[model samples]
Target: MKIVVAGATGSLGTQVVEAVRAAGHEPVSISRETGVDLISGVGLTEALRGASAIIDASATSSTSTKASIEFFTTVTRNLLAAERAAGVPHHVAISIIGAAKVNANYYAGKAAQEEILRAEPDGWSLLRTTQFHEFARQLVGHGKLGPFQGVPQMRSQPVAATEVAAELVAIASGDPRGIEPELAGPQEEKMSDLVRRYLAATGQRRPVIELSIPGAWGRGMRDGSLLPKAGTRRGRQTFDEWLATQSR
Candidate 1:
């Protein structure tokens, strides 16, 4: 089977591409490096020419709500439109856990993507997962304010991106089943603590300050909203473990 992986150059997308190969399927990668502009719809139809399924693992780095929403919605619309023209059967999307409840800058965009996918009467699977173990690394200096860094007041159960990729590949291999069970890490850890520990492991001496965000988004972060719910799938690697490996 030929699987087209959108955002093939991203962190999770790269792993998804590898998982596709490991699963004994051909992966057609779509990214700027490969001449495909997801938002612009350039090279999309041709990319999906012979694909059995297309996994949208793409993401945007913009923190602006408008930009994030535009990027996700545009990309999703373009992919679905091209898939219809190319006769691609399955459209697999990766989303964040509690995206609907949390209208935070980035989560709002994810929720918008989910809304679009749910309306489409095609073969599509939406996988919602918590933050990845690498998320802490990504947020190390996220709120850097001179000598003290501000960590968001949140709790996260982060799974390994590798595990998420394998699960997504497995889902794309079979028929679409709508939304799948949420996937998360083995345990929950405070985001501030995780960032602090990460800094220490990397031998970077910086004071970590927890920022109390306001509004529903902040509530969602501080509360258990970001944590995985009952029956949510779990992964083995702990944040400490991922950090330890990084320090080595």
Candidate 2:
């Protein structure tokens, strides 16, 4: 089977591409590096040519609700249109768990993406997963305030990206199951603690300040809205286990 991985150069998209290749399929990468502009639809038709399926792992880092919504909406519409034109039967999208329940800007965009995919004329499959274990590292990188790092006081089940990628590939290899089971880590964890541990592992001596953001989004984070529900599939790697490997 020939699989086209949208945003193939991204964090999760790279893993999906490798997973598809490991599954003995031809993995076609679509990204800016590959000359594919998902939002503008430039080079999309050419990139998707001869593709059997499309796994949309493309995403934006914008936290603005409007920007995020526009990004997902445009990209999804372009991909679906291209899929229809190319006669691609399977369209798999990677989404976030509890995106609908959360009030964050990014979640709003993800929720919009889900709505769009659900109504897709060509049909689609959606996989909702929790934050990746790398979330801690990302926070450290992005949440810096001078010499101190601010970590959100939130609960999370951080799954391994590789595990999520394997599941996505397995889904794409088979038939489309609209909204597959959610994937999460083995146990619940505190986002602040994860950040502290990450800093320690990297030998960074910055003070870690735990922040309790006040809002529905903050409440959802501190609460368990982002956690996986019952009957959801769990990954094997815990944050501690994943952290151990990261220290190498």
Candidate 3:
């Protein structure tokens, strides 16, 4: 089987590509590096040719609601159009847990992506997962404010990207199951605690300030909307376990 992995160079996409190959499938890499512009449809049709399935892990860094919505809508539209043209059978999408429940800009985009997938006339599957263990490190970088590092007051069960990748490959190889079971980490952890642990492991001495972001998005994060529901699949690696493997 041949699988087309959009955003193949991304954090999750890279693992998805390797997992597809490990499962005895050829993974066609699609990214700017691979000459595939998903939003513009450039190189996309050629990449999808002869492909059995497409795993869309593509993403953007924009935090603006309008920009995020436009980016996802365009990317998903192009991918689906190419898939339709190529006669591709399955389209597997990775989305964040509680995307529909939150009012954040990024989550709005994700929700739009899922909605588009749902309306596709072809076979598609949506896998919603919680935050990755890497979120802690991302917070460390984004939360910096002079000498004090800000940690949002939220709760999350952060799964490993590798684990999520493996599950995505398995889905792409099998029949499409619309809205599959959610995936989460082994246990829940506070956002501030995760950041603190990450900083400590890296020998950073900056003061960690816990902040309460205002709005529905913030409420959802602090009120357990981001946590996985019961019976959801849980990843094996805990935050501490994953943190131990990171380079100092």
Q: Name the candidate that leads on lDDT.
A: 3
| Comparison by TM-score, 2 against 3, better one | 2
lDDT of 2 by residue, 88-189 (tens): 889999888888889467888898989998886546789999999988987887899898999888899899999999998898888877988889888889
Residues 1-248 of candidate 3 have per-residue lDDT tens digits of 99999999988999899999899999999999999998888888989999999999889978677888898989988887888899998999999999888947778888888889888665899999999998889789788999999988989999999899999999999988899989999999999999999999989998899999888767888899999988888999999998999888
Candidate 1: pairs in clash: none
Per-residue lDDT of candidate 1, residues 122-197 (tens digit): 6899999999877777777467889988888998898988899999999999999998988999998899898888
Least accurate 10 contiguous residues by lDDT in model 1: 134-143
lDDT of 2: 0.88
User: After best superposition, candidate 3 residue 231: deviation in angstroms?
Assistant: 2.5
Q: Let me know the TM-score candidate 1 reaches against the reference structure.
A: 0.94
TM-score of 2: 0.95
Question: What shift in Å separates residue 173 of candidate 3 from its native position after superposition?
Answer: 0.2
Ranking by lDDT: 3, 1, 2
Candidate 3 TM-score, C-alpha based? 0.94
Least well predicted 10-residue stretch by lDDT in candidate 3: 99-108
Clashes of 3: 0
TM-score of each: 0.94, 0.95, 0.94
Off by over 4 Å in 1: none
